[model samples]
Target: MAELTTSWLGMRLESPLVVAASPLSHDAEAIGAAVAAGAGAVVLYSLFEEDLTEELAAPRPSGAGLDPYLRQIEMLRQQVAVPVVASLNGTTPGGWTKYARSLEAAGASALELNLYEVAASPEHSGAELEFRQVDVVSAVVSAVEVPVTVKISPFYSSVPAFVRRLEEVGARGVTVFNRFYQPDISLDTLQVDRRVAPSTPAELPLRLHALALLSPFAKLSLGCSGGVHSGRDAAKAILCGAHVVQLASVLLERGPGYVGVMREELSGWLDSKKMVSCEGVRGKLGFGFTADAHAWERLNYTRTLHAGLPPGGGRPAGG
Candidate 1:
């Protein structure tokens, strides 16, 4: 029989299909359904510091308090058979520490620190801005005993260095990127619309580069998020060196039952290749084992030389 189970951050999972933090994990019922639908693990909707502050700044009955969120997560973990991770995002060190510990105590198998802050302060330099994340990771790591994974944004001077700092600060895992919701312009009123959408398959190339950069670290479990659509995508991500594959936008669009589709596609691919388990095919094509690793890094420099007016413009002469 083909072995589908694997371990993520030391947590035993039935598959690599992790339900990335989304509204799909906001409540116990949703999580229970996901687990039933064959999710390897689940991440709760990120408890955003800014959103919580706004919620607490003024009392609102429509909002669920922190305790309720924790309780719901605890209830979720009990109802499911896979590892349940609670996600915490914050702007302040104290908030990260407090909430990380709270979630850990609430029966969360692990914690994901979404350390993303828009660097809008003019007084903050790049180094100074990143220092805040280092401090926050240190504080949160010290506060909780569970495995801590930091999901960071790609906006940085050096991604490899940033991931290294996170690992040095006791982070057990590093998720290279998170798909953030980009605002859209409404042509009618000329206003900003804040609805977040799911990612598509076109994003694989970018994620492949990130996985290549971080794979050499070896110790930290690297997870790739954004644009994972099928089992083929999952296999490609693993080949690129992602230990755990995070899925969200796709699940949101196709429903939790999508896990079965991914499983079918992945298993069929393995059968065609005569591979039995995910481990047999995992990281097989990674930079760790690749011959020409330049293909991932030489992207920008090579693209610059392609003499052409991209897409809607004129094609360049070669002959």
Candidate 2:
């Protein structure tokens, strides 16, 4: 059998399939099921700063506030042998250090700082926003002993430079992209409906492009998220140099046991390829490793557009 073991955020994972921060890991039973189903690691649902602030503003409820999140972390650590990564979703540097320290004390194996922020303020430049994010990461890193990884948004003007800044500030890893929830307009009511949409396999190419671009130069461990559904999808992530692949929608849609199915299929593919481990295929198709490094850039875009046109170099018959 091919070795499936890989490392992420300075911790050794038994497999590349990690459960992303989601409601599926809200309880010990669910976490146990995920571990039983072959998840290498589990990232608990995020503790949002806004939620924490709101809870704090309310009158005391006998230690029921942040205790739930902390309790979940402790319970998950006790329930599964794999690493239990605690996720903190916040934009600022102020209050995060406290919770990060608490999570470390709760026995979290590592921490994923989910920097899911939108720069809606005209006062802040892109550079200012990026620096603020880096400061937040630095504060959390200073507060926690456990490894810290940042789950970054894809809207950054320069991903590579930002990733380098993150690494310099002591982030052990960076998850490629964070899914931003967009609101839809209800045509009849003329109101905005905030709904969370599940990711599809089609989303993989975006993550693949980011991974391929950063894997060569990034010193931090690279993880791919957003549209990981099957064994093939996970394999593609590894090939593009992702140290690990995070899954949420698939597990929630198919149940935890599907992770085992993905594991088996991935192993089968690796065995057939005569590869010893995931590392063997890691970065095999990344920017620096590819014959045409420019393929991931604008050249590939132009080629794709030209290739799609008819032989006569005009639009198709439907046009």
Candidate 3:
């Protein structure tokens, strides 16, 4: 039997499949079911900074505003033996330290900071934006004792450098690519409307590329999120050097019990390959392990384009 145990953010997990931050975790029963179904850990739905500010500004009864969110984390901690990771989504640097401390007090094993900021302003330079992000991470890390990880965006000018800065500020892990929902314009109202869409398998390659590129230089734990719907997808992520695979859409679509199915499939693949554990196969096909380091750059790009072309360089039979 292949061992599926893996470590992320200094916590040991029974498997690589993590319950990503989502509404499914809002219920205690659902959390227990996911753990029973083989989820290694559960990341509670995010507490947005905007929501926090609004609540705090109104000055409700003591602990009235934040009590519900904090109570959910406490309930999850008591219901399952696996680690419970708390998520905080914010764009600015202020007001996170206090929340981080509260989460740690609520028995959260780790914290995931979802820096879902869109650089829309003309005055904010990339360097200024990057510095603000790092400052927020540093403040939160200093405020909490538990392991801290950041859910990063793929829009960074230099991902590797930013990852290094995260490590410098004491982040223990980095989850690749937070999905930014693009808004659509409504023709009738002539106003922008929010649109939400689930990830498809096609998004896996982008996560894989980011993981492979950073695995060689980053010492922090790497998590692959987005488009992981099956064991095969998780396997590919592991091969690309992801310490854990985060799932949200698949669980919402198939229910929590599907985690067990994915676990069985992943275990079977490992057994057939004679791999002892997930750690053994991690980074096996990453940039550092591959024979052609530049294969991920443009080598495969040119090869794939030419592979479909004819000898005469004209249209093929289908065309």
Candidate 4:
């Protein structure tokens, strides 16, 4: 078997496959199963800023406060031999950042700061929003001893530049994208409805594009999230310079045991290609590796347009 070991956020992972932050981490047993099935690391479901703020305003029920979250971190450290990463989801820096220290003290190997905010206000400039996010990350990084990795959204105008700022503020790594759940308009009830849908293979390209762009210049370790469904997909991500392949949807659908299956597929693909290790294929397809990545992208765009149009040009088969 080709060596699957990968170094991510300064930690040596037995494999590049990491279980992403999701409800799967809510169950200690489920997390144990994932680690047993070959997960290199596990990111616990987010401890939202709103939850912390609300608890401060008015204490929630007994089991629904910061104490339980901290306890969960401690418990997971004892149960899983792999790195246990704690997730904190918020946009602004405030007292909530203090919890990052607590999380580190609770034995979290690292922290994933999920900066999930919609830039909905025209009043706020992109620069201003980006600055605020950087501040938040700086605060948390300064507060914790554990390595901090930011989970960013794909909506940023200049992803590479924004990531540069994060790196300056002591971020050890970055996950390419965070999935923002969209709201649906309800015709019958005349209200906005919330829906959650799992990501598919189609979503992988966006992550790959970002990974290719960032992997070359970024000093921080890169993680690919969203749309990784199979071993082939995982191979594509690593080829684009991702240090780790973070998965949640497929595991949720197929159960944690699927982790072993994906690992086998990745190993099989590497063996077939005669690659000896994950590092052997990393960044071979990234922007920096190409002669002219911008020109290549433009050429692909033109080719796609030319091949997509039918003779009449009404619509293509899939269109």
How displaced is residue 201 in candidate 4, in Å?
A: 1.0
Comparing candidate 1 with candidate 3, which one achieves the higher TM-score? 3
Residue 92 CA displacement from its true place in model 4, Å: 4.0
Q: Model 1 over residues 1-319: C-alpha lDDT tens digits?
A: 4666766787778887788988888666766766776788998888877767877788657645687778878788778888889999887777888888889989999999887778878988999988878888889989989999988888989888888898899888988688765899999999998877668877776887788767765578888888898989988887777877888888888888887888778778878878888767666666675455567558655776786566656434441
Ranking, TM-score, top scorer first: 4, 2, 3, 1
lDDT of 2 by residue, 1-319 (tens): 9999998887889999999988888857877887888889999889887778888788556433578888888888877999999999874577789888888998999999999878899998999989989999999998888999999989999898899999999999999888999889999999999888888887898999899888888889999998999998999999988999999999889988899999998999999999999988998878976555665587888988878966766644665
What is the C-alpha lDDT profile of model 3 across 99-217, one tens digit per residue?
88888898899999999878999999999989999999999999889999999999998898999999999999999978888888999999998867778878899999899898987
- Write down the worst ten-residue block by lDDT for model 1: 310-319
Candidate 3, which ten residues in sequence have the lowest lDDT sum? 56-65
Candidate 3 TM-score over all chains jointly: 0.91
- Which whole-number lDDT from 0 to 100 does residue 165 have in model 3? 100
55-81: candidate 4 lDDT, tens digit per residue? 899998856567898999999999989
CA lDDT of each prediction against the hidden true structure: 0.80, 0.88, 0.89, 0.91
Query: Which candidate wins on TM-score?
Result: 4
> lDDT score of model 2?
0.88
TM-score of each: 0.89, 0.93, 0.91, 0.93
Model 1 ranges with Cα > 4 A deviation: 289-296, 299-319
